[model samples]
Target chain A: MESLYLAWRYLVYHRFKTLLLVLSLTLLFFVPVGLRVLVQQTALELQRRAATTPLLVGAKGSSLDLVLSGLYFEGTRPEPLKGAEIERVQDSGLALAIPLHLGFEAQHHPIVGSTVEYLDFRALEIEVGRRFVFLGECVLGAAAAKELGLAPGSTLVSSPQNLFDLAGVYPLEMQVVGVLAPKGTPDDRAIFVDLKTAWVIEGLGHGHQDLSKDDAAAGVLKRKGSQITANASVREFQRITDENRDSFHFHGDRSAFPVTAILALPHDAKSKALLMGRFQSKDETSQIVVPSKILDQLMGTVFTVQDYIVAAVVLVGLSTLATAFLVFLLSWRLRRGEIETMVRIGASKGRIRALLLWELAFVLSLSVLLAAVLLLLTASQGGALLRHLLLT
Target chain B: MIRIQDLSYRYPEGGFRLLLPELDVARGEAVALIGPSGSGKTTLLRLISGILLPEAGRIHVGDQDVSSLSESERRAFRVAGIGLVFQEFELVEYLSILDNVLLPFRLHGRLRLRDADRERAAGTLQDLSLGDKMDRRPAHLSQGERQRVAIARALVTEAPLILADEPTGNLDPQTKGQVVELLRTKAGEAGATLLMVTHDHALLDLFGRVLEFGEEEGATTLVDREGAQ
Candidate 1:
């Protein structure tokens, strides 16, 4: 007890060193724990979003890219699926498909133009105003609402598809019609619009009215019979509409308009499994991904390296602690006269040793506790920031 | 009683050697060891307390021959049977006077001197005229007061042998007389054998015997014994 008591006293005496040691060990502990929490929160967000949509089908490529671009709204511009492909799924009685036309951006945030079902699938309930019903109208995620400071009537001009695209691509101005409630996931950062709007922004489709020469000559064609047609033109041209949309023109058939991907939801597991198998074996340029399984694989690879790094850091921390202890032992030898004085007073060596060990244990235990508390605080706060950064 | 026979010690640094053919002290005897700084007074004290072993020789304290004991055994013997008052008053600076005095009892096993032990330490400090300062740490105590606390600690366990290094070397004349008198009185009442090493020649008459260190040459009477003052 005396020896331990002495150790304890010595550690207490050197309060600064104890603090430094605790800090070093805390950093050693913090990284792994913090990363783990981030990973957990991210995976949870991904899984929650994935569950809402039963299936994600994209142009044949990395399944991970499909999930990232389709579900998480991340990754590069994947080749678009023909509008006919989505029609194929919709024509089939087995599944319901929602077309997602991505591959565009406005101010570094991706512009996701899809059917109303995308919002329904995400379960993003409106907190204020109405949903997008007209061309150029937008529904903002909670994060987008806060970040862009856009509300019911706020107007946002579309920036280039690529965030770093300084050359300025389609910079079309769009109106924000609604803001969705926070989903604690990536749904907060997305800009939702009608699929046609995405196509128009990509210069792949345009809004049109059939022109009559005689009616144009009569100067009343605007009020006469002019069939509204969906225009598909890959090339840029001029535009003319009630909205005075643009001068960019695309030359392509409306029926063959391109879509980035499709989200399918089957009624049961059998249908889902069958749909997934078909996509896997299909000759069409498409692949299906289960977000949950992909996440597990991702985490597996991540954790392997993370575990190794944490183990090495902890080993180094422990070794430094051991060296600190050795310094203590060596110092004890230098203080033999002082120790002898204690022994001569009837203090047993055991007591002295106990005091020494107690000192170190107290400091280490305190440091670990402080680091844990800090981790908790950071997880709670930093988690919010991460959701905003990675999710909608 | 304390006894040493054919004790010879060599410094690891190859300094002067210490050789004693015979040395003895009976119970309640007060002896003074006078020597210059490097004459091995502290080394002899350390040897007697079993802190250091004589290169070759024997050191017997009562019925136990310390030179024959193991390192751990010697530590136990030193804690239980000998009281050492260091010249520097090497008190564990963090502990209060009361805890310092009670330290030996805490160190040696089977000697549970908790509340009662503290009470005994209080009494010893009172006898050393330091009762009021029991709760104070050594840093707060003056030089004379610190020395008394060290002495009080040595006497707290009521051990049979008291070895002091330069007990009054730093005290004023009046305090030096008082300290030496206290040591003699405590040794007599406790039936303890006291060996004090000092350079102060004024205290020669206070002890029953004295042993001078070093060999004499033509100009220097290097080893001249002077009884207690």
Candidate 2:
């Protein structure tokens, strides 16, 4: 009790020095802990998303890119899979297949072209309004809705990926149908649309005039006062409602159209093995990748760098700890007179050492508390921090 | 009561040494040790308080052979049997004057803090004309006030022997006279054998006996005079 009182007095009397020591020690401990927590948490987050998605089938290049693009809705457009591939998976009875086409953005957020099965697979629930019922309607993810400040009945114009490719694609105006509730996932950052709406945005489907049928019987007539030519403007429906729903159609066999990737959910282990075998044909232009394994390998590369970085941080932390220890030693020398005084006043040598040790314990305990608070704050924002740092 | 026989001390790192053949102070006696700067006046007080162990001697404060005690035992013995008033008034500057006065009880550890202990501290401060200055730290007190606080600390525990080293060495004339009178009266009232080293000739009149140490090599030449003014 006497040691405690004396130590408290010293700390309070030299408060400025105590504060400096606490701040330095807190950062020294926090950096290594924060780095370790961030890496482990990021790996867990990425692995969770990847684990749910068993396999991704996409263009025959960077399997990591395919998985990242298909599962995470990130990266530039890879060579797209066809609607026929999705059909083949469905016909094979091997798995549930959801298609994703992401080569566009709206307000700097990814616009995902997928099927209604995508919503079911992700377990997304609408927080407001209804799901898309027309070709040009899109639903906003929770973060997207909040960031764009859009709700049901609002208009969202898809941002064309390439301005110079205006002939092939243009900014298509989409009708906001609903907003998804916050899921704290990557899905929260995307705008989801039906595959047909994605095709309209890609200029592969549209409402246009039948040039050969300038016949009055078909309701094709020249504007009475305006000049008309063989090339009549094909009216691309900017907004889709019940009236213009029939006008939007793909020009060719829609089954042959493009999709970014096919997310395959194999029914059983046997079917997964069988499906893996089927995609192994040498003539195949696509490859099947297990998303979890791909993400693990991707994280392995990151971990190598992280290991070196953590080692460096550990070295710095150790240096700081050594400096603090040295400071403690110096302070002990400085307080020799005080120690001698206490001893002369009938305090045992053990009591003097205990008093100093109690002071140390108090400071270190405070530093540990600071480190814990910092770690929790970082953990709470781990997803957003990782998204900002790596995903974009 | 205190007794020393063939007491000798040598500094381990230096060549300073002092050997006294014999010295004795009876119970309830007030003795003043007067000496030149290097005559071991303060050293004898430290030896009596067990702050320094004699190389070859037996020094007893009451019945205990303090010279034979271990380092820690000596500390306990000092806390239980001896009170020290240092020349420099070694008060912990961070603590309030009351805490400084009660320092012996705090470090003793066997003594529990009580209202009575606080009252004793207040009473000691009151005797020293510092009743209202309990909350002020040493840095806030005047030199004479700090000396009184140091005296209060040494006396608060009511130890049997009180050894003071130049207790009034730094005080002005009027404060020195008042401080020595208080020390003499209190030690007599408590019946604690008092031994103080003083350079002030005027204060020596208050002591019952005076022993003077001259500038001599390795010797505490006793020049004793008994007549308490």
Candidate 3:
């Protein structure tokens, strides 16, 4: 009890120095802790995404680019995989392939063009309206819908690639056929579409002709009653119909359009190994990367920086601890004459030592508690920002 | 009872020495050590209280050889049996008068401070005429009041031995008479052995015995004299 009183007296007597010590300890405890929390949660999110899908086959190019562009929603526009690659994987009979065509944008959001199978495997739920069934239809994720105020039947014009896109080469008005439920992942920020619609938006396919250009040229329009061959070959599928060919944006065959990446489930690790071995680049222009390995390597570098920060925090924390000890030591010395008086008044040496130690322990315990509170606040703040960054 | 046999001590730096061939203090006997300055009176008082150990001989307090005990054992013995009053009052400046008085109990972890203990502390304060100043810090007390607080602390412990080093040196003659009378009455009531060091010869009449010291070339010599009273 005497020691406790001494501790309280010391703290109250040196209030300013105690405050400074708490501040230094708070910084020492929270800075690196926050950084570690951010990095660890970010890596966990990336790892979770990576774990859901077994294989990613795209263009036989940089798998890191494919993972970044396809899975992480980062990186520049990737070189699209050919539709023939899908057929090749299907013919291999060792995997279920989901084609992803990404390159077009709608109001600054990337339009992810894939098949219905992709939606099923990704477990996306339609929150409003029906799924896309036509050429000009798109489905918006929750974040995209909320940000753009887009709902069912809302029409959205695609933003062009360049910031100043006066020429408007990629300007296609798409109707919002559905809005997706919130999925706390990168899916929340994307727009989904059918492969055919994606191909049409990329200027690869077209619907039936609405009119004849000959009659339009003669200033006589014909609609509803159009005469055309119903069994036209795939080669005749152009982005513009006969009547609107003059307004066609791009010239390409329907089957030969570009896609960003293809997500493939190779059934097992053996197949994954086989698939990866099949796609190994003999040339420097193409390479296959395991997403996990690449991520681990990236995180290794990130963790190194984090280690340095943690080390610095630990060193500073130790110094602050020393400061606290030094304060107690100085106070002990300052009160020596007083202690001697106490001894003269029948105080034992053991009691004096006990009082000193009790005071030190009391200060240390309070500072530790304060440090813990600060750490919790810092962790939660940093966690929220990271969650927003990764999910939305 | 306190007995000294051939006690001798050198300064910590070995530049000077105080030597006592023999001395005896009886129970209920308040003796004053009268001397000129630098006569080793304070050193002799410290030796009796176990604050300083004698280098060459024995100090027996109630048949216990204090100078032969280890430091820890000596500290325990001192806290339980001896009380000391300083000339400067040596109170903890940050502590209140009550706290200063009760410090011996606090340090011994015997801080029951129950109704009886508080009553005893209050009684000690009342004896010194310091009942109204219990809550005041030592720094706020006057020279005379601070001296009374120191004496109250020594009495509060109720030890068998009380050693005073120039307790009246900082007080005026009126306060000095009040303090000296308080000490004689309290120590006598407790049956404690009282030894005091002082430069004023007039204060020796209150004690039964007086010892005088002289500084020789290299040693302090002690002589005993019965007080005229």
Of 1 and 2, which scores higher on lDDT? 2
**Candidate number that wins on DockQ, 1 or 2:** 2
- Best model number under lDDT: 2
lDDT of 1 at B155: 85
TM-score of 3: 0.62
In terms of lDDT, model 3 sits at 0.75
Which digits, one per residue and each the tens of the lDDT, describe model 3 over residues A1-392? 76567556656656787677666656666566666777787778777877787777776656666777877565666677667777767677677878888777877688888887887888999989978775667899999999999899788876666758654344566778899899877788899888866776655654433235443333333334664333332133233333444343334654456767777778788877877776765753323456677666766876787799788888877887687668778878888887877776556767778777776666566667776776676555554466445334
Q: TM-score of B chain for each model?
A: 0.91, 0.95, 0.94
Classified by CAPRI criteria, candidate 3 counts as: acceptable
- Winning model by DockQ: 2
The fraction of reference interface contacts (C-alpha pairs within 8 A across chains A and B) present in each candidate is 0.57, 0.65, 0.60
By summed lDDT, the worst window of 10 consecutive residues in model 2 chain B runs over B214-223
lDDT of 1 by residue, A196-230 (tens): 77777776655333233333333332343455223
Question: For residue A238, what is the lDDT in candidate 3?
Answer: 31
**lDDT by residue for model 1 over B1-229, one digit each (tens)?**
8888989888887757888888787787888888777888888888888888989999999999999998778877887788888777888786778877887765677566678778888998998888888878789988888888888878877789999998787788888878888888887798999999999878878987888876433111224354634
Q: How close is every model to the real structure, measured as TM-score?
A: 0.62, 0.77, 0.62
The alpha-carbon lDDT assigned to residue B150 of candidate 1 equals 82
Q: Docking quality tier of candidate 2? A: medium
The predicted structure with the larger TM-score, 1 or 2, is 2
